[model samples]
Target: MEKEQKKNKKPAFVAVKGIYEIMPAEFPWWDRFLEVAEGVSKFYNFERIETGIVENADLFLRSAGGEGTDVHKEMFFIKSNKDKWVLRPEATASVARAYIEYGFSRLQQPVKLFYFGPMFRHENPQAGRYREFRQFGVEIIGGENDPVFDAQAISLASRILKEIGFKDVVVEVNSIGCRVCQPAIKKKIQKYYRTNIKKVCRDCQTRIDVNPFRVFDCKREECQEVKKAAPVFLDLVCSNCQKHLKDVLEYLEELSISYELNNNLVRGLDYYDRTVFEIFVEAGSKGEKKEENASKLAVGGGGRYDYLIEMIGGRPTAGVGFSFGVERIIEIMKKKEIKIPAQKNKYKSVFFVHVGEVAKKRSLKLVEELRKNGVGVIEGLSKDSFAKQLKMADKGGAEVAVILGQREVFEESVIIKNLKTGIQETVPVEKMAEEVKRHIK
Candidate 1:
């Protein structure tokens, strides 16, 4: 009875909620993004870097705004008997940790690095937001506190999005004051919120004492209403911050990058100071409806974090960067029906077809030989039907097909067939590579 019940028990297994699988069908979009990222990185002189996915939890806790912040609330902690570790919630913090640990600070000034990987955040998934999502970004660290680098980073991000077919890319930029004037701005916000706290949302009410600057990041209509009347960061910035922001805007204008100087654009972090900005695809572009929450559709954002390195135990090094959510970019591509141009590589333009048991057994060796000669030989050796194999070669858009059968295998030769035309020729096995290359060319 126990054995019968055990045999009848249904298998209980399903993917975790909020997490998603990136299947083969969805890889073309991913490949397009990565291809663009690689090309841009090379053009911009950014070196690629990758850090461990798991790190000490305190690495993020110390860098991110403690409590009430998105990172603090959504960070996924890995359970362990020893010290607690976590799957990194963001790449910037991990990059900072690596820079300090690897002594990148001692290298050339402003070491530019690019990274692409998954981040884990246990947040409610929506639209293109998932628990496990990919992010590719470039960080410029260890430079003089220069506004030009800020513009360059922004330009790089804008260039990437536009290259990938996003239209009307507008930058929402702001300066959240420096440490010298931040306290005063926070005090003004607190005093203003204290008087009309009732009009604000519950989150903003708590933000009043915890981190008054965060009140600007609130999305609630009631909070936004009260926030409009509250203290603006630009109104309270010091002279140096004012000059820095003005210089950044001038650079943007010089580059012809569209931007809006928003006083309410306080990014959701404590470590960001001076320059802060977010990149958005303006609604009404590509026939998108202009919704009220269109600002919430930010594809990417980052800013100058002069204090982030110091906060994470490195010397006070200046850093600026921006990241795009891969899922969000892919979603927009699908929605807009943007056609990513198929990669054109001569190596991948040829297909190999085989028939009979002997040819099937020998096809593997021939395929490897072609691959060794820098040819991307694709095959369907498992299919026993010769007609079906040829059909597949045509469907794959192969310019040429290398055919082999039991007789050809015995003769130590391969039939070189032009897939576009019906012309065919038998080539000696020793000269097969040369003939295939010539035909494909």
Candidate 2:
């Protein structure tokens, strides 16, 4: 009966499906990505901002294109006593909400903000995709609808990727037109898809009526031909949008940023208008053999959302921003085998080895004191064997070892040993930290 009860005990659990753990071995890659992202953001004069993960469900439902879109279908709802809330599917909408709720508009014309955090969406996971993924994003909001801000936003995204080992990024840009011209463009897209409606996917068939722009975003093979032949909005945008797009392109050229004029690059979100862009890189980068059908991965993208602020209850505001999927970017870095620079220590690092209970009791204090003097130290206090402690020190790459046995502890002296040369010397306990520093150096 006791054995049966033991057998019935539950097994150890694991992380939820599609959730990934950032193990210690993978931290260097993450560090490099975040370092470049944050550095570039600050260099570009953008302030950092973080918003709560849980926000009102209606916040996204209203601004993220309502029902039927991928975001709408993939949200994870949270039970609450008050209004419905959800884990944010993206950051831009939350940033916009913060801009309005915090009254950021009262201070400046356009508030520039950047963020790095996790976003949630309940979707089928694949390589480089997860139920919860991290994003490094930026937002430019509240200013006049100047096109230069659009170019600057794009430039910032491009610079960060390039600095973080992505040398072959191509910016695929397009103009989806504003309210003034979208209606006509929509009609043209709808009419084109209507004739080929039977050939397209069921989703595209529905989108053609609900939002014809989204049909351009379909990946269905059946809809490819239909979408390719659909009307191009670039040719039909109003005079204002045309000039805006032209100005943004010229700024990009002036900055020497490479870009392609994509005719079918309407973004997935509903808030974007006037300018939309996506950054893509070939899978064969870093001298890898190129395949004829090597599909490009979109590391990041965003667009101008002039009406997003007003749409979400704030006064009229123009905003343009972009976000990079941290996982996708890191995946590309690993594929390229990009090396992260090793962390440098000005002072040499040493290992602390102690034997006997008395020395072990004194080991912690010595380690802390050495640290206070700018000496890097690794210690094995729980390790009772002197030989094992030294082995651990060598494995940790420590340059020197500080030995403290019971006799040395009582005598007020310690042994300083060079790990590489195997040289040894006895020093006063007060000078042990300094002696180790000197030898390691």
Candidate 3:
């Protein structure tokens, strides 16, 4: 009875909630997107860099701007020995930490780098939003605080989305100024909110005194109405901040990239200063209703974070970067029915087939030889029947199948059959790899 009970028990094992697996069928779309991103990075002269998935908790606490930020609250913390480490909720802080630890300052100024990896955040999952997701980002560090870099970063992001088939994309830009001008704007914002405190949400009321800039980012209906009447940062900025933004706009115009100036477009992150922008795509034809709905679908965003490196123990360095959620981009591609061609080689694929024991042994040697010669090869050597093996080769998308049977083994030769043209020829064992190549062409 006890044994029967044990046998009837159901095992409890399943994938964690909010995390997903990328199956083989969907890899083509991912590959195409990454290819375009890599090409864009190369064209812009940005080198690739990678940092650890786990980092010191204090690194984010200090560099990402204190305890009030969303990035801080969403961090997944783990204790290691006496220290606390967190799964990186974002890469900017990790990259900044790497810059300081590796002494990148001694090298050339404006070290451009890009990264493609996964980031973790403990948040409720939704469509295109996962607790663990992949990100592709680029950063320019150690440069002079030039507005040109800001425009360049935005231009690169816009170009990438365009190349990936997002036709109706727009960049919304704003400037919150630096330490020199932000205090005046903050004071004005505080005074404005204090008068209408009861009208705003509880969260916004709490955040008003702590971080007034974030009040512009509130999405609630009640708070948004209050925000519309608040003081705009553009009018309150100092002369330098004004000129910096104007120059960025001029450069963007020269590049032929479309942009919209928004006074209330403050990013949620605390490190952002001077210039901030978000990339949004239109769902359909441009109209009042469609435009209003499209603005909510922000595909990607980033801005200048000049003070971030200094906060993490590095010298005062200027930096700018942007990151896009890979899953979100893929979701858009599917919704738009964008087709991606199968990523096959320029050379035709050669499938290997064998009949009988001796040919099976020899087929292994031929596959290795073909692979070593840089030939794309596929095979079904386990099947004993020749007809079934050939069927698999056709289904596997092979252009040609190389068959080795008892007769061919005795003659010390092999038969190469072109699946497309139904042509067959026998070649010497020593010349099989070369002959296969010739037939594939």
Candidate 4:
């Protein structure tokens, strides 16, 4: 006890700030989620990529748009005495940075990559949100501005939902259009908001001049009225935007991808172009045992970024990606009562038992020898009573308990007792490894 006390004990993580950890209890659910994400990705030809968390704040400010979307408005920026940096607000923008820096275009067209990591945003913490939250997402870069690819990314987002036992995936899709149609839409939207500025929320009024489309995205009651009457770009999409959107829908129909047309949908990013989409919830509605809150609960979203690569100083390569919030997925899983697999027993080998100090000391050497030979052994060397030692062995979930005493240690043999069958036999210590392997099989 004194020797154990002399060693420095690991510090307890007591009162960990925000949302993050690596502990034994968390492994089952995390492993399950990873297994599902990896399986779905492998089934769909997506490889993995990990990007560093710290980035230049301008990367998000320029690419996510000057518009005060969640990323720009709530990013966690760090200004040191020497330099300025920011934690990543989302994965796709960083993926775009990786695409531009690493020359992925030289290797393959449509470089499909998967990512799982944490993103930081300074939103008020809620049921599905935290300052530090994780995201699991995939991106396909170095492709042409194809509507089929837009539909494909949305389909992959839905595939993850289904793989994670989500009952229904309601995809809300729209086309935010290209440079030509988008400017006109912004003009008309600003004009309309200009007249009814008093009726709009304070944020909407500010966004009227800077980011009027985001005014439609507001959920406040006053903004809802503005959104209800706002000019929709879907109605004013040009010939090229019209055909691309139509082609995207046609591909969805061809691939049997189910979705709803939400003309009001403007994703919270600046660089998005043409088709955009969000995956929502419609759970427990198949039969009468349905949920009262079976409405549109958004879990994942993404869209086309025809100008993102260029926005970050690269060639005019189109990129599309989808991101699912890990915490939100966990919240929904809890609400839907998803079952995580239990951890299996780790005590599958022999438990060493001894009577006195000499047997106990010698028992340590034999225990180490067995372990060195790839055997799992549990021992209570300080324990002198047979009853107490066997009790510890029982609690370990060991299949068999090896009994060693001063007599057995002197003979250089051990007694193996099958806990399940209560049978005993004497086996030489040198042959114990082979005997235990047989029992294990």
Candidate 5:
């Protein structure tokens, strides 16, 4: 029985598919990011929402457009009893579904909601792209198709990033235009690409037929050559779209926000429209001491989605939101040597070290009592040595350790060892929990 138990306890030698451990040391950084995200959301009057990861596959297939978009092509599909479910590639569709399902429209004019959690996809893990990753997203569902909400939505994301202690980040904006002009512009651009397809890369060639706008998003060197003559989507914007684009820019300027009109900033997904923007920082730029060489790293993006709610069977409603890749942000923060305080509070208490089996058994219950009284308690019940357990308590940042032994237990008392002071005192067993809490503070 002991041998089998030991074998079962063996450490795992291989990590599971697309899954990685979030070590305890790294948790403080994640907690800091979450805290900042919550603070910014609260300041903006955005409520929090948590939707399940498993969603119907068609919701994405339709929301992401049929065949060519990133979500449709790179998603992980799971087979259930009779239907196919998918890990949500992103959160906007799920947020839209939540808004429709819960009848949130009745509460307020534009229901602002924020969510931070792990979103999944099956993709080659690179620096920024991961199979399983965390996204901090916010959605504004409701209100007229106003560009003010569009500017506000993007600004909310920028504000959240700014509060997270990042500098040198630029807000890049573009108007993909509304439904009236979006397709017409894509068709016009495709006509130019149709003639230039032979000169572009193979993927760009296929993109010309299915998703004509994405052809301009090519990152290949050979494709860049063909892009010199590719028609810009903004060149064909209709009158209303042209006016909306101009107004959005005016609003941004009113906010004292600096932005560059990147006409080529088409988002990867099909759901985006009219207002599309990305936030990036140039590494090695002045005023960016915290993140050296973190230049042009795409931190977050968002746009308007007035047609998405109606596409999913809900009444026509304008929706817009942005999401931040938490892991990628953390990666950049680490490379820049940026610091987030881990242990904000001082050590509250210490471990109970046991010298014998009986002492170990009795100390477990006492440790629980300390914890119940709002005290942080550390323990090493498996350890047989008093020295090793005391060392562990010190490493746990415990200010004191409660020593339990045969004599102390029989006398209905325990010895308290102050780790920092090296002072010891025997206290009555009944007062053990209370005294430890008092002394640690």
Candidate 6:
């Protein structure tokens, strides 16, 4: 009876509500995405950089701004003895912190960096949004505040999405100007909202007083209606901001990347300034007429944050970067039924199947030898049955299966089976690695 109770006891723990595990089956898709991202990063000559996952809470509050931003509210705080730390809500602020601590400014102008990691956000879980999700981002920091960098960042992001099989990509870009012109634009928006305050939501009412630019970011039905007639930032931007935006647009045109001028698209973050852009993918083919009212979900976005470094205690530096939600990208791929082929190293395409304890021991030594010889090999040594082991090899898509049995082990030889041709041959132990390569060819 006691034994029965022990067997029936329920699990004492479960995964946290919004957190998830990436199982082995889903690794191929992730590996393929990272391969493409790395390839793009290499082509652009961006160095990979990683920052700590936990940081001072003030880092985000200062860089992302006060209560008006989502990042500030969604941050997960922790108490470490006397010091307060927060799981990094985003990478931009952390990267900026690194730039300051490492004195990256002393190295080179416009130091290019890329990162891939998980970010924590305490938000409502949805299709693509999660409490914890992976992000792939790039940052170009220091140097002159060139509009060309803006266009280059967008181009790199677009190229990554295209390479990952996203079709009908669209970039919506806008400029909110720098501190010089943004104040005037904010006043115009503030005045407009003050007049239509009754028609707007409670959130927009507060947004008008704190961050008027965020008024346009509201999605409330009533607020959207009121925002339709709200003042536009493009018309109020100073001449420098105007020319900067114009140059960015022209550079994008030269790259042949299509874009829509969305004057109302103010990104939800506080650090953004001057040019901001978001990348979206149409649900279907380009031939299908897209509805003007049809909403395109944004998979990735970023913009210039010229003041963020200074805000995070670094010297004033021009910075531009973009981050893509890895989960969202994978979700879109699955919805489109896009199949990612398993990434098999050509040299490691051989699978080893062994039967009985003697063969299993011999197979382990043989596999290590093959690896030492620069041959990639896979094996199911833990699996005892020969049939089950062969099935696993087939499932792994191995080009050839190296089979060994007690009899073959005793004879100091192995069997090389061509999985595709259904042909088998016996090769001596000393020549097995060479024979496997020949079979692969």
- Pairs that collide in candidate 4 are none
- Encode model 3's per-residue lDDT on 10-52: one tens digit a residue: 4476457777568777788899899999889889999888999
- On residues 183-251, what C-alpha lDDT tens digit does candidate 5 reach at each position? 788888788888877788999988888887787689989887668666665677888877887888888
How well is each residue in 1-441 modelled by candidate 6, as lDDT tens digits?
122346777557756878856877677778888999988987999999999998988899988886547877798888555676889988988888898898898987899999999999988887667888999999999899999999999999999888888776899999998999988888888888898899999989998998888888888888877887777778889999999999999999999998999978887888899999988976543355767637467889999999999887777899999999888887667666665765656566789888888888888899998888777787888888888888888887888888889999999999999888999999999999888877777
> CA lDDT, every prediction?
0.86, 0.88, 0.85, 0.81, 0.80, 0.86
TM-score of each: 0.92, 0.94, 0.93, 0.84, 0.87, 0.92
lDDT of 2 by residue, 120-189 (tens): 9899988768999999999999879999999999999999988877767789999999999999999988
**Best-matching candidate per TM-score:** 2
Runs in model 1 with CA error above 4 Å? 1-12, 67-69, 282-296
Q: Candidate 4: minimum summed lDDT over ten consecutive residues — where?
A: 1-10
Give the poorly placed runs of model 2, Cα more than 4 Å off.
1-11, 285-287, 291-295, 345-348
Off by over 4 Å in 6: 1-11, 67-69, 285-295, 341-344
Question: Model 3 residue 355 lDDT?
Answer: 94
- Could you give candidate 4's per-residue lDDT for residues 187-234 as a string of tens digits? 888998889888888888887787767886888987777677777767
Collision count for each candidate, in order: 0, 0, 0, 0, 4, 1
- Predicted structure with the largest lDDT when compared to the true one: 2
By TM-score, the candidates rank as 2, 3, 6, 1, 5, 4
lDDT of model 3 at residue 184? 86
Candidate 5 lDDT for residue 74: 83
Better of 3 and 4 by lDDT: 3
